[model samples]
Target: MKYITKNKKNNKQPRTAGEKKIKTMDPALLQVRPAMQESAGFEATLAFSDMPVHQLLKQNIQNKGYRYPTEIQERAIPALLKGADIIGIAATGTGKTGAFLIPFIEQLLHNKNRTGLVVVPTRELAQQVAEEFKALTTGMKFRAACFIGGTNVNADIARAGAKNHLIIATPGRLLDLVNRKALHLNAIEVLILDEFDRMLDMGFINDVTTIASLTRARRQTLLFSATINASQQTLIRQLVQDPLTINVSSGKSASSTVEQNVLEVAPNENKMEVLFNLLSGDSFEKVMLFAETKRTVDNINKQLARRGVRSDVIHGNKSQHYRTKAIQQFKTGHTRVLIATDVASRGLDVQNVTHVINYQLPQTMEAYIHRIGRTGRAGKKGIAYTFIN
Candidate 1:
């Protein structure tokens, strides 16, 4: 759980973690060379009116209605295209996906059948990124696959081997496939670690380290996080080469668009009743309620059903089919209330969610922010209420 960014120029100190096992490889296979020429300007300012990347890819970008680059995209994309190791620090919902996805897709388009590996913290995030990458590469006949938990392992391995150009996955499932000797990392030249901080927080350090070691040492490595503490910096240093750093202007606090409020109540005094009172209005439809445990989620769903409110519960213990159904009901308006635990916070990407209710406050402030982020997306106002006992 310790994240250390390898200082940009510092040498790695040898440490004993079991016996240090080293593998010898051909030196030629280990050298990762930049395929694209380096540029000095941001992609945002580049007058794409004439710059040639690929007429077809440029057309795809324009069709996506993206006329300008975000701060992270503006700074990071050029470096990424030049194949530099990069560490990007920016708040959530800042189009970090596009910053990497554009370059990733372009590489695939130009290089024909090359694979890029993207590692995330959770299954939802893996699916979300895969969807976004798929969208960007639309009309281009490149193949991509997602390898994450809650799915058949044999199915994923078969998909992974079928000439896919991109693999977006969570660390656990990716490492699982690696352990089974069902995945091939030999062809992957681009490796992106999105939400690098969350992976560190979720006890995925050892797994991520092992997965990263499988790639060519000189692969283009992109590390992104909301906040990069000292330890994460050290880890990045150890894992990547000299990485260009981009620090965007974060609001020095939680998301500015989200309206945060608190409600104090007794522990035994039906939190569901309090939730009903808060959600009594007609203006909110897409609502996400969070509790601290799977038992609490089930209890809340029961109370909501008793009150004639159609709701669904999602947690770790539920089958993947049930979890998917719960998410679908809330998303499609078949059921307006989605009850869940902290597990749904990081990676679910349903747009226009109007309210996020914390039936129970998270143990830490970071968890609180990520929970509320499920709503108020795509530049719309969202409300978050916390029930304190």
Candidate 2:
């Protein structure tokens, strides 16, 4: 029941689990070139001012200090604003949030009567999108109600039933409200599925399908994902109509801003020791550690706390309140390390995350990209290290 932790003062080595079964390494997975580099972008021909966005939205953009659009934003905004159903293929932190938000706000400004629904995969992402919406639509009389899990269902029902211009939600809670006749989607004009693939991965595709069907006649349908698989193509086709496909993702890699490498933990080597050494270094100011299961994430967080390290954890097992609080602590620098499973991998944006450590290998390269994508955001450089036993 003990974890291996290193004490540099004494060069102490602690006991760890027995040797794990060695799996064949995929060269393709190992060749994940960093794509977060500043130069690794599609050159934009138009600035924020040049786009046909509403003047107020434009001013709001300027107030936010957004001078130019990222490649995805630059290409996707115009189409989204033109009322085209869009499939925006872009990684997290590539300004994909703004890409759709700006144009959608503009459209709303032009016609306030139109209602919209933005469905995300996780509760954290639902909150992040809501905050971004609030920030971007400052001074505007836009009303949004967030219906995520981990809150009182009755309270959410009241809010969902109230008049709102937009409904930002997670699939489960939204469906619950819809089933209760608290939220009506028959008149929804815009439907946006952010982190589309993640939702599918979480087995929310059926729920998403139900939600999208309710808005079949919506004016616009926008789908955004870091990675898309062909198996989901049939479902995606059912979501959008005559959609303009836009892809700014750099194939498999996330960003050049992240320097990625792997570490080999010998049979007797404590992976915790390697992680501790990294965190003790000056470069890893704030770190996000990823494990494969809820138990592992909790174990690591508990061990770190035992060692007097400030860390917090979030996973599917945690309530929405705990997850939100954990993220808040990380944002306020109250926690040096935020440990979790792959739940935090998609659409969770925390600024200035200096490094990301994969305590164990992710099941797929896509998950690795998203995990590292948490760092190296907002044009900041980051480091990612994976432990291979």
Candidate 3:
């Protein structure tokens, strides 16, 4: 396989005396070449066949019934395995977690005492990543500690102080631990900023920058996001060094498999009535509803319950136990609807979400993409209905 090398002619000059000179590769120029398509109904070509994956991971992949890698996974796994810092841009539900986790765990298994830090924007994402890491590292000696807000800080400190191989955390809690001297980033060999655009949207830039400054300068960094903007590009330039940019999509934020539409409500019409009407229909088997604030999420969940809709709610104000329970109930099919704020937009990975309803549109287009992304996962057809008041 021929790889695209960084263009030396596009290198950017150093801005200051002590600043490191960086590459100026245009994101448009760095695209992942399309791989051979698989025959209809047969397992797709395995991109990892030629890569140096562990025998145990190979068995796990087979056991989990993974036949072919997603486009991002196909391109990213090999580059990450080769120890290249990468900036991966792919839509949600494109198997990004596996793309990064596989190579990360492989490196941990191959090297001794090497620690990896995966910083995400929300607690749900941190937990989801930790679960994926656990699934991949089953029967291995690696230990992962999940540090997020709302959990006991002392317990988190104990876990961080232990001999853990992986640290999956949100920025605020991780920075708190670091400030307390309970967790150190000096030993980190691998650093990943998953859903980084969301981190920027959530106003975590300062904390993320501080945490990155704490880590060793020579570590490998992998940054993944569905969309990259000018501010994000500035951060990428400051963080990663001559990174390989892999873009799988043609810059489409939302998934193509999702049928998106807007339900316009007249001036005098009640938006809740329209929502109730849609919920009464037979088209929805499982649904996710997004609102703009915690109070709005609670009100919607309450209104849905009063109107005989079995639903739950999650938000920043809820305790960790309540949020986890709500997610589990939604995932197990016990609830037909899960109403949430933008907090659920990023990394809530429930399966079979037949419909995603925007009771209110998100503040940013990126959040809308993530909210709709909850559905249409795993190549399944889904619908996204937005209520426009």
Candidate 4:
């Protein structure tokens, strides 16, 4: 007997099938305003001395070659050390990671069992945060477990089962572990939502709400973002208690140190040709190129290879091993050019990135800021080139 299956019409359709859809900013939200200018010839000379940080942490800070703190760090560290829930509004490359890490490390040193949880939007950011924690906690007896996607579940389960003083993770994986009872949030004394805007932009609000609800009610919650929208404000009002608000960015666009320009190309002109022309210049050393899709990134990498351009590509399609290796190669100058999607826009901190080329414009102005932020970091001069067609 032959059996026939009836097709059911579903009202809810998946937004995407195989590849991830590129998120676009609403045009109604796009109004070009004058860039907020910083005071000329005015320098912030704030050192970390006045803060209530522990002596051991101070020693670690000096050892890490950090003498003066960035504006956000200088302001946030004091309150964080005082166990204050804070809402930090700062742009990328503003030492926001250090602002939160130092206080958390100091807190863990006093009480090892008081777990600290940091939820980020991307795996790269998680890895970077973990590295920062390790660097600051050097020679200290503290363990950190990083939970992200595209990794071994059994290994993560084992790591989570171990008594970790610090936990850095992406929302989905952390929520999965929590559901499986492999990780407990009840003992979490500190909860940090880094890049909260990015999390909201990536549609992880539900997961974030669930995870935040699972944590201790009296936890010291810190939410950091480039911009705070209405949704993020609502979340903050619900999650934090009498939060100390700090906005060091002052509504700035990309870094003023970066020379921004646009190249106009005709619709019939091949973007690869334009990119090749740009890469042909000697000044394009240590460049990062941003594309919109994994297929586009791969294609650009392959084309650059054919033309003998030392380039590497990273996106969701590649395994974690390959992605990490590519980033390392790019960081070590083994690869002159790195091609990526928006995945690399946030939480990618590579030094000496001389140029950031937007092969295609990002869907939102905020994303554009992050993509350009990969360069002009650490008070270094860099250039941002955007292609217009």
TM-score for each of the candidates: 0.82, 0.91, 0.87, 0.89
Candidate lDDT (C-alpha), each: 0.73, 0.82, 0.80, 0.82
Q: How would you encode candidate 4's per-residue C-alpha lDDT over 165-229 as one tens digit per residue?
A: 88999999999998888988887888999998899889998998888888864479999876666
Best by TM-score: 2
Provide the clashing-pair count of each candidate structure.
Answer: 14, 7, 0, 0
Worst window of 10 by summed lDDT in candidate 1: 1-10
RMSD of 2: 4.2
TM-score of 4: 0.89
Q: Which runs in model 1 stand beyond 4 Å of their true positions?
A: 1-53, 62-65, 249-252, 266-269
Worst 10 residues of 2 by lDDT: 1-10
- Give the TM-score (vs. native) of candidate 1: 0.82
Q: Worst ten-residue run, lDDT, model 4?
A: 1-10
After superposing candidate 4 on the true structure, give the runs of residues whose Cα lies further than 4 Å from its correct spot. Answer: 1-42
> Which scores greater on TM-score, model 2 or model 4?
2
Angstrom error at residue 163, model 1: 1.2
**Model 1 lDDT, residue 331, Cα:** 77
Q: Model 2: residues >4 Å from true position, as ranges?
A: 1-28, 31-42
Go through the candidates in order and give the C-alpha RMSD of each one to the true structure. Answer: 13.9, 4.2, 12.5, 10.0
Q: Arrange candidates by TM-score, descending.
A: 2, 4, 3, 1
